[model samples]
Target: MEAGEPTSLQIEKQSLHDQVASRIRDLIIEGHLEPGSRIDEAKLVEQLGVSRTPFREALRTLAAEGLIVIRPARGSMVRKLSRADVFSMLEVLAEMERLAGRTACERASDSEIAHARDLHERMLEYYRSGERMPYYKLNQEFHTFIASLSRNETLCEIQGNIMARLKRIRFIGNSEPEHWRAAVDDHEEMMDALAARDGQRLGDIMAHHLSETWQRVKNVI
Candidate 1:
């Protein structure tokens, strides 16, 4: 074995840590652990049947992801974005997606564009089945895929960082049937614009799509 190589047990421990983190992330995003609520670490550790080490490690992971705030003496609480913060972050996201839409139209290969179309199709199927979380998962993936199509690493990196904070906001935004339909409609048009290679049209649609999220989730905080 190479010096400094992690042993198999160490790998398993890291994997367990990541699984714990993912579970916690889903709890926050799905509203099971409401925003601004303090994380009852002892209770959760027992519930998850894991020890304190992994649970605390998971908290650190989520803190880095912007999903939770860890205070020196106050323990940790879910990071709740105020209405103003929501607006500000979504504004930046909207602008970035707008640029990505434009750039993707210019840069994405035909196969890549078709692949995005396929992802949208799968997401629509989940929507048809009325599966909210599955639909949102695909919805998130589709947006990230579009951003990656820009082929600009910096843009994708910045967008991802902002998105880590806004995950719950975006997830909850489509709680209503009307809001979900509106979002789907926007995506449908976005696909059309992309297929036509109409960067201007796609950019406008993407910007409007994110801007509408504010209306859907204004009261969450």
Candidate 2:
């Protein structure tokens, strides 16, 4: 075996868990599962066509990720974000996005920068067209692209975790037209900083951008 290669059993186990996790994650993120709803393990296992073992493992994995809370007698429920949780998470997201923007400005290639600009423009069009769902999806992709362009895997992972945790709150904000427009404008500023390749300015802009979102959504969450 190669020094870095995983054993066959290990690879299989990871694949099983990831498959199970992805199915469950989709349900939660798409709002089908609903926050604070009880997870019916029997129903989920039937729907996913997986057995108890893998289903339970997937639940444990999600619990570890802070997406769900498993209580002993009460069973598993989707994690509810308190107002405080929203504020604290936004604070962390602001810092993470700032780091991502700074690194992207420093390390992203010209092609990467151009791609980010294209995504931003496309999202703006979607926003203007009043296609809320598509715009929201594209908006998420744009931020993720910028994070990936930073070329720091750890930073990207951290931002991904933050995004996952905040997805429900973000959806709440997006449902409001005024907040949606404000978010689009912030993305424009972020794109401008990336175009200039000014790491310092990009960092500051990203932090402020996330901070504004926190301000807008904290009271509602």
Candidate 3:
């Protein structure tokens, strides 16, 4: 009964679809629904205890995020990232990250740098503990924070989308002890560059780091 406030029914419906989409996303991330395998819509609908409408909406959301594909006759399926696909996405990601590094070096505030430093420390703790999942999550946050420090909305949006597409593969890249340690070292270098306000150096380092990361992912996948 208030302006700009969603009705209870509207709130409930939003909750339903968000829950459904989150579940499907987790399933895909956990590899329960293998890449390139078609999603069984009817089966998922039954299992999720939802009707066709919300289930379809959830699939469409994932499709938009590049997690799934919805073909005309074939239906929705988890997206399979080929070597080329991964490379292309990584190429864009590298450039975006490079730009973020350069811009953040010039524009990032002391507070922002401190925030990143805190995240870096936490990530190191996760790495030392051998908690891959938590470390990966922190890894994502660290990159995202750098992007935000860029102060460029377009770059951040583009970088975020590409990162989302590469999430599952990037996690796999961390499966190797050597690769993971190298990535952490790269982060340390990036932090140094940011603190010193060396835009060009940070940009170069960011590009090379992402390229090396792609090599690791390529070898594994």
Candidate 4:
């Protein structure tokens, strides 16, 4: 092994911390630990069966991702967004998604598009069966995959960053049956335009879908 190289134990520990972060992230995104609510660090740590070290590390990671806010003396709390804040973020996200969809149509190969289609189909099944969490997870994955098809590193990075912050809001947006069905319909149109390689239409749908997302979730947030 080279000098300064991390041992297997080190690697395992890092992965453990990452896993803890994911667990906590899910807790926040699923509203188990709701927005603007202070985290009960001791209780959560014990409940998760993790040491304070890794738990605190996970919290710091979330803080960096804009999902949680950590104060100097006070404990951490889930980040809260105002209606206007959501609107502004969605506006930017819409533009990014618009560009990503258009570019993906022009750039993505057949196999790449097929893979995204597969994910969408899986998400659709979850929706059909009324499994909200899995459906929401796959929905986010599909959108993120579309952005990757553009093959623009910076665009994907920015989109993922913004998407992370809005995961909770977006997931709960589909709490109503009507809104959930509407979102599924948007994905259907998006996939159709993508398959046709109609960049213009795909871009338009992407932009409009995000705008509608704001409408669906604004009341809740």
TM-score of each: 0.90, 0.76, 0.83, 0.91
Off by over 4 Å in 3: 1-16, 42-53
For candidate 4, give the lDDT.
Answer: 0.88
RMSD over all Cα atoms, model 1: 7.8
Q: What 10-residue stretch in candidate 1 is worst by lDDT?
A: 1-10
Residue 195 accuracy (lDDT) in model 4: 96
- lDDT scores of the candidates, listed in order: 0.87, 0.80, 0.84, 0.88
lDDT for each residue of candidate 2 in 1-221, tens digit (9 for 90 to 100): 22432222122333386788866875676577778989988877766667888888989988877789999998999998888888898899989888988999999999989988888889989988998767867878888998998888998898888887887677667677888888887787888888999888888888988788877777765
lDDT tens per residue, model 1, 79-122: 98888899999999999999999999999999999999999999
TM-score winner, 1 or 3: 1
Pairs in clash, predicted candidate 4? none
Candidate 4, 111-198: lDDT as tens digits: 9999988998999999999999899988889999999999999999999999988989888889999999999999999999999999
TM value for model 2: 0.76
Return the top candidate by lDDT.
Answer: 4
Query: Tens-digit lDDT track for model 3 on 41-94?
Result: 876776677788888888888888899999999788899999999999999899
**Residue 24 in candidate 1 has what lDDT?**
80
